[model samples]
Target: MSAEIRLPGLPLVALPGVYTPQDDTRLLLRALEREGVRAGSTVLDLGSGTGALAVAAARYGAQVTAVDIAWPAVLSTRLNAWLCRRRVRVHRGDLATALDGRTFDVLVTNPPYVPAPGSRPARAAARAWDAGRDGRLHIDRICDAAPRALRPGGVLLMVHSALCGTPATLARLTSAGLRATAIDRTAVPLGPVLRSRYAWLRREGLLSPAQETEELVIIRAEQR
Candidate 1:
């Protein structure tokens, strides 16, 4: 189950300015499959891009909520979910802010884990992947906020590159009173964003010139 899971070639109607599905998306889907999501399960897709994960979960018969900070991404998610005949509650707000006072059976995220030179992006396409230096910015926030957003026995399945510091993610989730482990891992090439900052990333010791691919890990944390 280490390979990316293709969604049977389902067409996603992604509009301009929305982040399209790619390797990380498939990887997250593979991890989601392992969760054994039951019919009518409540699922949340934080930072939902194009609502691909939401649609996938809906296809599995789960009630899905897809949240993104970008308005265009929200509309794209809504459109794609409708295109797939899957119902998704779409919202545009900072991560988890729009989801207050709600809990879910499962939470899945492929956040902006790419280490960036500065703070999170503002109104740029880079918002999809430009995480702050060391790439734990959103990851830490999720680990902190996820616990309350999950019901007892709830699970979180998050995917990020090894360069962002997997141990930190595991430690954070564990410290947040959840049992955390890397349930799955796979290698993937650097995307355009990472490629653009290759030199800085190398200097920061997150990568090497000889490296062609970075390992992506799915961290599964369960409520205690």
Candidate 2:
């Protein structure tokens, strides 16, 4: 499976302690574009990280708002937007809490989908990738909040590892009254976080001995 590449030539700033753009971010951006994130659309990017998606959307002429739980991430996103000469509202909050009562034309996220054995991330940069035991902590929360967060005809493009259960995400969105589908997928080698837990993953039957890669899926849900 092929992965999405970064936006060509957009200057980005990486503040220490912020999550940098990666395969997941690129995949979600591709999916978002395919789903029709165009000029004048109001877009929200959760777990905005380096604000790569936000900046990309702004370049496409969309009004964007990016949110991250970490202050450094929020700061980094703002810097990246400035570097790219695009304007994006950056906020510090958990998930959709910062946008309560606001709806968007599109919602995009490259949330922490790495399934870890801990009850919670250790803090700092770890919070950017370590999802709880099932890896659906943020995914589930996003799904639950989607219908309410989206305006009619709005779309949600989210990327996550398939190990976290793609079907669960689809079901949650569908049950919440949206037309949801897994629109794209790609396989990438285990990163340091996943590699570090390789043994535990094998023991938990989440990964196999010969599997050095993890499959990522982009779930697109449209509010109809």
Candidate 3:
């Protein structure tokens, strides 16, 4: 079944199959709202599945550009924008490549942070969930490109799993000349039982069995 999420004054639909919005998206949206993103600010939503974040930003009066590599995601963003009666630019491509030379005042992203072993290369959910070996593949690229795409003093708010090199992501953003900090965090219950990657990690002694909690980390960074 599909979940319906109401974000303050915005209405958005979550996908029934494949991907869904986690609590981290809500936390990131709240943080962005607090950061004063208004009509004048241009916002970018990376990996914008189902257009929840983009719709929320548009409702708040920001010009939003929603990008996803998958065609389904692009279609979702377009349809959601129509449903909400808001204008959002929807593009399909990898990372910010579809954006060309465009820059934004606010950038929001909920990237794939799952470290799936031996997954297919171009599957939609793989693009949405898997992030290479340590799950930092896409995260690293986003952090590196954000500084260049953001206006000085502009903010990049991102949501990622805490289990996959979160500290390294923070360090990467800092090294890329952006001031980074964790704005919010939440522990979500795991859905997978014994077949989960977490379970395998536990078995391999990589992670403790008590680490079934999925930690969502919200990071806020500003270009220097």
TM-score for each candidate, following the candidate numbering: 0.93, 0.94, 0.90
Residues 1-224 of candidate 3 have per-residue lDDT tens digits of 44666666667666544366657678887888788888768999988888888888888899898988777778878878998999998988876474588778998998887766665574745577777656777888898898888988888999887767678878999999999998888888764522367756565454666765677888989988
User: Where is model 1 more than 4 Å wrong at Cα?
Assistant: 1-9, 119-122
Prediction 1 TM-score vs. true: 0.93
Tell me how far candidate 2 lies from the true structure as C-alpha RMSD in angstroms: 3.8
Question: Which residue pairs of candidate 2 clash?
Answer: none
TM-score of candidate 2 relative to the true fold:
0.94
* Residues 122-186, model 2: lDDT tens digits: 58888888888888888998999999889999988899999999999999999999999998999
- Candidate 1, residue 201: lDDT: 90
Which model, 1 or 2, shows the larger TM-score?
A: 2
204: Cα error in model 2, Å: 1.3
Better of 1 and 2 by lDDT: 2
Q: What is every candidate's alpha-carbon RMSD to the true fold?
A: 4.0, 3.8, 2.3
Instruction: Rate residue 158 of model 3 by lDDT.
Output: 90
Per-candidate Cα lDDT values, in order, are 0.84, 0.85, 0.79
Give stretches of model 2 more than 4 Å off: 1-7
